[model samples]
Target: MKAMLPESVRATGADILLGNTYHLMLRPTAERIARLGGLHGFMNWDRPILTDSGGFQVMSLADLRKLTEEGVSFKSHIDGSKHMLSPERSMEIQRLLGSDIVMCFDECPALPAERAQIAESMRLSMRWAQRSRDAFGDRPGHALFGIQQGGLEQDLRAESAEALRGIGFDGYAIGGLAVGEGQEAMFGCLDYAPDQLPSDKPRYLMGVGKPDDIVGAVKRGVDMMDCVLPSRSGRTGQAWTRRGPVAIKNARHADDPRPLDETCTCPACTGYSRAYLHHVFRAGEMISGMLLTWHNLHYFQELMSGMRAAIASGTFEAWEAEFHAQRALGDIERV
Candidate 1:
């Protein structure tokens, strides 16, 4: 986060930043952060910060995690310490972090589970979601969001959404779909997920996605999303561009005297050329990752801006078509 955002905040201007609850709880401990004066003061980011419940990591990253009706017990991925995470504990951590938006702790089961398994997980998460709300109490500016987890099945998703609404939350998130399901399947699930929730409240999609994925999600009525793809891809020398994903370290870019994207105004696009970026990437220079991360984040912000505008104008369909068409034209020299 420090590597990616400080420069971009001044260069491109970002409004809000997202934080990972799983990583923070493991390292700094939310109480320690609160002692230091909340996440905003600790990180020096004054804008809004959204923190997820550690529920997802408990299921995904732990080696020997056990789930039950009460909560989850798992060995820490970092130090092998046994820990139990309940909805109440998750709420306490987010409160300690002083996040603007907090997510309800929900069990995100792996996709392709049996119907019975999915139903069981959804029921447990709904129960936990209620516990999270009860634990959160209330704050004037702070908002709690509930996560809907039912895999890709429409009926289950609807049931989960209905349960979350009944419990009441400031927002709702479509969870459990991005965990290995392809875009087609994920989109199919999304077709019904957002509709299940109230239209007035914000709709969030957790741990989602590539450039095209974001566009498709917004078009399907999702209002916000968070993903680590930009920063993760940047470390590996991949650049997401208007024309599609670009491999910055590829040999073909060794002598190409062009920016990553002609229309982009990121430092990588405005100040540096492909040849220089390629050299930096191959040499493992620190600046390569910083610049590429900034470019990818800037592109995401741009995509959001376009979608917001299109939605306001009621031309989202046309914009989505053009987005796909542009990505279809692969590697081409802009002469």
Candidate 2:
């Protein structure tokens, strides 16, 4: 996490960072972080930090995780220790971390679930959302976001949204779409998901996606998104550009003299050539990941900024058209 940010700081010039409640809780424990002067001091990030409730990770990564009416029980992925994560426990963990934005604990089941299973999951999450809200009590300057999970079914999503609206939250997140579902299906879901929730609240999309995916989601009314793809792909030699993604290790770029993307203002684009980037990545140089990660994150932030500006100016349609056109053509050689 520390390594991912310094490059991001240089590229996108982001002021704040996100922390994972589940990851931190597994290692240092939120209590320890609070005793050490809260997450801000513990992580050395003075700016606002948003912590996820760990629901996704608990279901996705942990083995032997059992779900019941009370909560989820599982063995720690880091260690073999047993633990239970309930709504109350999740709220206490976030509170201890002193996060500026906290997410409500909700179940996120894998896609293609039976209608009965999806309905049950949605109802359980709603019940847990109430518990999370109740446990959090009241805290000023701190925000709680509720996750709406109903798979790709429109009716289920609406039901989840209605339940969340009744419970009340600072923000609403559209969950359970980006998990192996194609862009078209995801977009179809997003078409109604944002409108189903309150317009005044910020809408977040979880575990989303490629550069094009981000642009499309934003155009469809998503305000925020999170993904490990950019950073993870950077470490593996993938560079995401406005044109498209370029696998840096491809032999075609072995002697290319131009930067990754001429439109990119990232240090890697302005300061380094594709040939050099390819060489570093092929040679297993540590700086390769740092540089490419910086570029990818910069690209993502630029997309976000462009969308925000377009929305404010009411030119999102035109901007989205250009966004789609740019990616339609593969990255051309920069002379």
Q: Against the true structure, whose TM-score is highest?
A: 1
Model 2 alpha-carbon drift over 4 Å, by segment: 5-11, 333-335
Task: Identify the runs in model 1 with alpha carbons over 4 angstroms from their true place.
Answer: 5-7, 333-335
What tens-digit string does per-residue lDDT give for candidate 2 at 1-335? 53365434644756556789888898899989999999988866777888899898898954569999899998888777888999999999999999999999999988777889989999999999999999988899999999999999999999999999999999999988887778899999998999998999999998888887887788778888888887888899999888888999998888998999987888899999999999999999999998888888888778878888988999999998998899899878645
**What is candidate 1's lDDT per residue for 288-322, written digit by digit as tens?**
99988888888878888888898999999999999
TM-score of every model?
0.97, 0.95
In Å, residue 232's CA in model 1 sits off its true spot by 1.1
As for candidate 1, its clashing pairs are: none
Residue pairs whose backbone atoms clash in candidate 2: none
